[model samples]
Target: MRSGSASSEFSRGLIDRSGYASEKFAEGYDRHRLSPPPAVLKILTLVAQAERPRLVVDLGAGTGLSTRVWAGYAEQIVGIEANARMLKWARRVTQEPNIRYVQAFASNTGLCAGSADLVTCAQAFHWMEPAAVLREAGRILRSGGVFAAYDYDVPPAIHPEIDPAFAVHFAARRRARERLGLQAGSATWPKEQHLERIRESGLFCSAREIVCHGFQEVDAVRVTGLAESLGGPRTIFGEAAPEVEETFVHLREAAERVLANRSWPMVVSYRIRLGVK
Candidate 1:
């Protein structure tokens, strides 16, 4: 199990990582990441009809993947991100006429009060301060507006032969956390727990959930690209520290040996939870 002790310091460290010079991380993630499942649109549409959402705010919008999803539907779509590199990439790559980007933390976005008709966090609630962000969501959203969060549960690998590579990858992650002294201090928790946290916040009414599944294919190149784009975490933790890099390299070599020349299908399962203001 992952730790539940994630702290502000850790979050700050992530915010300071400053992404790659060429924005490789943002590009890779946008390319390989799962598409916004239908449930996200369904929920947004359901709420849009009731509130006639003119302004949609996507917190932790990262590379604008989630922000672009609302382009044609909303009169204006604003993507807020803490990381400058991510916002830069989002601004450069996504050219929607009605979509825009801003650099801001999820916990405290400097948006106008009651300006949003809908708020969303896609695969990013884990990194936020739940109570603070939820309170901020409530502050910015119009009365009776909607808030929704969703994340995909990626099962390392399904192919038996390739599973071993994933095993090594997971072990490396555990070791990396241990080396960083984050095992007991960092906890992303599970996606489902996020829903519970929302309910506990008491900021919204009638919170609900929807489970959606997406299918895709993965090869060595895709998997490696994902690790590279996200970070050297799964394959090779670049220049961070010797111990961390060792663990990453080990996993990379192991995966390299196993996935010499093969590809397999992957099932990406997503759980989307929605609530009303």
Candidate 2:
């Protein structure tokens, strides 16, 4: 198959399988999932306090989790998502009158230039092509508007009992990607090389800030569900990796045991970057 056709097929399969995984795991996401990490919540609150933007744009507003955070503060909040299945779930969960969800990609938001006072991408930055997204974000933001990108970094360690399960899960995912001819690189895409690309775009005032924060007392079941729902594992395993299911079960059981003993908080870290348009 041509590269484009192969990519399209891969993406379609990935999205369809992800929708199934999410549906199977939806309750856990809603009930046990941690709210926005502290750094992300702080950034949103800071923007709300600073700009109280009349019109706010949320790119990659997956399942409306971030959209709900800003719905009360912004006069009007527009959530743009590419995945129809996710947008459907967002519509059902997000009922705020000020929030409107659109089916669109981050590269081309279908929004007018200079129309928004703030544009935010929460926990979904790596999924985007930064150079293209930066230009699009710059176009949609009013002069002096803020652009924020916030995401978390998985700690290098896990609790002793939980660590083995995650190791197996990750190993299976790597094998799956290899089978599909995908490359697994560092958590940061385009690495440090892309920082200059963003700065040189001249779309935003040349300044960068990295805000760090930590989270504890996270529910274990929520963590498991979030990892499984993220599409990486299922995309790779494709029903062949028994270890994936076994690891999740082990993790879930361990979490329950830890929760019963009131010793279940997991330490997590995050970073947030903001610039001016």
Candidate 3:
């Protein structure tokens, strides 16, 4: 499975791994991050031809949020995560009898070959070495089994006035991160190329992309919590650089003013790339 040559590239992901290393970050992430949309289960099952998948493996499974979604749909589910902090929370909050967590790299899950009916990476695929991860996913997926990598768009659409401020906050964070040269620790592939990578891997017989949206009711606290849960933005904001702090304050104030202490419907857009082995 090209494990020998691919081993080095896997470690490159560790440099950026620290982005999610903080216990506080994990806690906020678990509390505020939106769980993957229900459509994921239906689509993966339909494509894999497994109404009830025998086994599902979730790679880069942060806090088991994505893994737990499949508990009722799969006979067994395993979450492979490398971060101790995230894994700790994953174990603590997870109560599904059929689900379990394993600390491991996405490129080397250590699962039995051909044992998984479906393999998924949700909101976490961009941080992985695509080719190496695809190789491991291919090795573990049975013929006709599906491998799907999906992510949601950031700054979920809330209110018109608040959305622009949200964009400003994130853009300011990006600028601060670049100005500080904090980008050296990690590497990431462009999300737009996920479908292309899956198709070019040749391990999959076919590949395709899907678009979906999810809606949830959220209050002002949830809005700010979502902002705080972001890795890069959180780090940049923690520095309390005047401009960035001002941007965050602007967002918070906007949310509070616009929502008026009431819950508002929020929409998150998701992109899913699928491959069939």
Candidate 4:
């Protein structure tokens, strides 16, 4: 495994500087952000079921959305996040007794070595430096402990009528990233490559992807909220773009029009990778 210093430097640049925009988007992150697809929940449930971990550490645990689910099965759940505002909301919103929230970066959790039964990062793995995080996670876990990383793969289509608009939404996001000087990469964000690196690091006894699916019914209001939570259209527009808002409003209105006469379901795909040390 790579030394903590090496991982820390890489992660600090990737997360603290390059990924800083994410923190700005956190306030509105939950609103338009799609829920964890069913596949991810199932995998998480399976991990909790199989491990029945006494102590679980949730890395990059934004707002405790994933941690809340694990809290039921794990004897104790510790959520570590770097963003203070998000951590505050996570602490405020989750009332689970077994769950504790900490403001800390995933690259360096500060927890003692060999103390955790399981370590999981949901939807936030791309934001981390895998080599560093994997090393730290391995150090913090007892023998036979598990480390899991999971994220959703948004399908190409949202809805027949709204599909084009969703395309525009993504286009706007790409433009936003470009404006911020971020490089464009594949949709998967080096996931497979990172998994290979983790395997090569020899920190895990085994590692593989867990497949899962999710379905949800999104109304206009909920969709609007989700968009807002994701940095409010402003993140994409730089300044509020009336045209983008109009597009989202139109999409919502179209959804309403469809729902008034029929039922529509949105399906999401997810991949969860689990590594056991």
Q: What is the TM-score of each predicted model, taking all chains together?
A: 0.77, 0.77, 0.91, 0.79
Candidate models: Cα lDDT each: 0.68, 0.63, 0.82, 0.66
**RMSD per model, one decimal:** 5.5, 4.8, 2.9, 4.3
Backbone clashes counted, model 4 = 11
- Local accuracy of candidate 4 as per-residue lDDT tens digits, 1-277: 1124554554445444433245545545644566465456456546545546788899978777778777667788999887666677778778989999877777778889998988888777776767778888999988877788876664323477765665565566555655665433323356656567668769998887777777777665654455444323354354434555665666667656655555456666777778888
By descending TM-score, how would the candidates be arranged? 3, 4, 1, 2
Q: How well does model 1 score by local distance difference test?
A: 0.68
Instruction: Return whichever of 1 and 3 wins on lDDT.
Output: 3
Candidate 1: tens digits of C-alpha lDDT, residues 70-186: 776778988988776677878888888999887777766778989888899887777676777788888998888888888765434445655555555555565765676444212
State candidate 1's TM-score: 0.77
Worst 10 residues of 4 by lDDT: 227-236
Shift in Å, residue 231, candidate 4: 6.9
What tens digits encode model 3's per-residue C-alpha lDDT throughout 83-164? 7778889999999999999877788888999999999999777777788889999999999999999988877899899999
Which residue ranges in model 1 land beyond 4 Å of their true spot? 1-10, 17-23, 47-52, 156-160, 182-190, 217-219, 228-265
Q: For model 2, how big is the CA root-mean-square deviation?
A: 4.8
Lowest lDDT sum, 10 consecutive residues, model 2, at 1-10
For this target, which candidate reaches the highest lDDT against the unseen true structure? 3
Misplaced by over 4 Å in model 2 are: 1-34, 37-41, 44-51, 155-168, 182-197, 214-217, 232-236, 261-265
